[model samples]
Target: MRSEDALANIDVAVLAGGLGTRIRGVLGDTPKVLAPIAGRAFLGHLLDYLSAYGSRRVVLCLGHLADRVTAWLARGDSAGTIDVVCQIEPRPLGTAGALGYVRKELRSGTVLVMNGDTFLDADLRAFVASHRLSGAEASVLCVTVDDASRFGRVEIGPDSRIRRFLEKAPGSGTINAGVYLFSAAFVDRFIAAGAVSLEADVLETLPPGTLNAHIAKARFLDIGTPESLAAAASVIAGRES
Candidate 1:
């Protein structure tokens, strides 16, 4: 199915709850999602991108400076093409826990979740179509980067089933892009099982063939560090142009 069609039934979730300790020196008290990029808040750019794909609604799981982010949303920072909602974490919940915190607000059977600080320039239509075709309970977006030391490696079999997740180490390898598609049922299961870290507590524990891998050779941007954050404006401008 085309992304627009698939997205009509799939809500997008942005995980913006990280402490962003690495970039704190530059941003001060601003939430990482509200960091300025290309003359606009990074969250605005992200919402514009999602709006292009006709995403219906976006549920932002916010922590760290949740109030600031929420205040920005109230100011109409979103692109106005999609409905945006905030789910503030009472306390810091790991990635999986944050999702569980907003479980009641998600209206879709499947949800597309991605990190607020990372952007993957890929065809959402293809990604969504592949996931729907595979019938996997969960699917992860993976990309091969020159240095896997920053992000852990993901091993997928020839069948595209995720086999294992290796801890971050010095090497060039395929790594999770921090974007995932999950069935509501699987998410509920994880919440029930008390899964915390999405990677370690849930993904790593899943059987070898349980997760599908949607590998793409796309430009990946992560604004988690000073260097990367500095480069985001250019990357985002390039994408927009």
Candidate 2:
């Protein structure tokens, strides 16, 4: 099915609250999401992309320098509807932990979660639709990278269900594209368990086949480091030209 048709029911959550220490050298005091890529902030482009994928509502998870992000979104510019929520961490809670902090705001039947540090060209609307139809508790967006050792690699069974989630394993395999679709039930589970890391804490408790993996077909770029950020700028520049 077409992505737009599938994603009509999903709400988007952009994870933008990290400290982004890795890229601080180039983006000092600036939240990674607010870092410029091409001629606009990276978060702006992400919002535009999500809107194109049929997202009607977007919730941004903000932490350090969150006010800048809030101001940027408040300016508007036809990038869909946006809501910014601060996710201050008393201590570093990791990925899933930060998400747990905002459980009250996630009221959608299906939620699409994306990392603010990366740019993925996957059809999120279609990804959401596939998750809803699969009857899985959660669906993760994945991509096959030449080097999977730097990120979490997901192994899928013949049934198309997630069998294993390996963190930073060497060699070629499918790695988490920093995106996901979670059912309302799964979100409830997080609230119940008080978990931290989504892969290590929450997903580990789920029964096998409960988590689904969807492979992305487009190029994926992670702008977490100074070098990668420069590359991202180049990519964005090329796109705009």
Candidate 3:
């Protein structure tokens, strides 16, 4: 099946509930996903990207100022024709836990999960093809960056199987791009808690050879910090254009 077809057949979960402590000073009450990017909420660009891939519905896992996000979604300026729903976290459920909270709501065998604060200009078709060919329960999109110091590196072997996860250090390396495709069973089994992290607690602890690393060269943007947030407008505009 085409990648678009695959995406159309699955559900997408956007983990948008993090406390934007890093960018809080600049955004104040604005949720990270709602931070204005090129005069629109950053989440708008994210939804646009997914829509381009034939995604019809998106489940937004919200927390920490989730009301602001829901209000924006209601206005419907950015969502266009996509079906967007908000699943407000009862509390801060970390990354993995938030997905766990909405696991039952997801209605697909395979699901796409993304961090709401980051964007990757990648080929979803190729990534999806890799995941299917590898037969892994989960796949992490990995990107090579000039400086992986700000992000933890994902170590993968020659076969593209994830070997281990490395802590952030000053060096160039392949880092997790924060986009993941997982089998629903994997989410239910490993990410089944209300206070777990997708990174440290799950991916990092998973046994080697169990996860696939879908490598790609893409323009990646993370709007977690003030400086990165400032750069997002131009990057988002360029990508959307």
Leading candidate by TM-score: 1
lDDT of 2 by residue, 172-210 (tens): 888878888888777777867888777688876677788
Looking at model 3, report the run of 10 residues with the lowest lDDT sum. Answer: 186-195
Clashes of each: 0, 0, 0
RMSD of each: 1.1, 2.3, 1.4
lDDT of the structure predicted as candidate 2: 0.76
Candidate 3's clash total is 0
The Cα local distance difference test for each model comes to: 0.90, 0.76, 0.88
Cand. 2 TM to true fold: 0.89
- TM-score, every prediction: 0.97, 0.89, 0.95
- Ten-residue region with minimum lDDT total, candidate 1: 1-10
Question: What is candidate 3's lDDT per residue for 1-241, written digit by digit as tens?
Answer: 7655658877899999999999999999999998998998888888888887878778999989998988887787765757787899888888888888888779989999999999888988888889999999899999998888899998899999999888899978999999999998888887644338888788888789889999998988899999999999888888878
Candidate 1 residue-wise lDDT at 34: 92
Q: Measured by TM-score, how close is model 3 to the native structure?
A: 0.95
Worst 10 residues of 2 by lDDT: 77-86
Compared with the true structure, what per-residue lDDT tens digits does model 1 show for residues 194-234? 99999889999998989999998888889999999999988
TM-score, candidate 1, is: 0.97
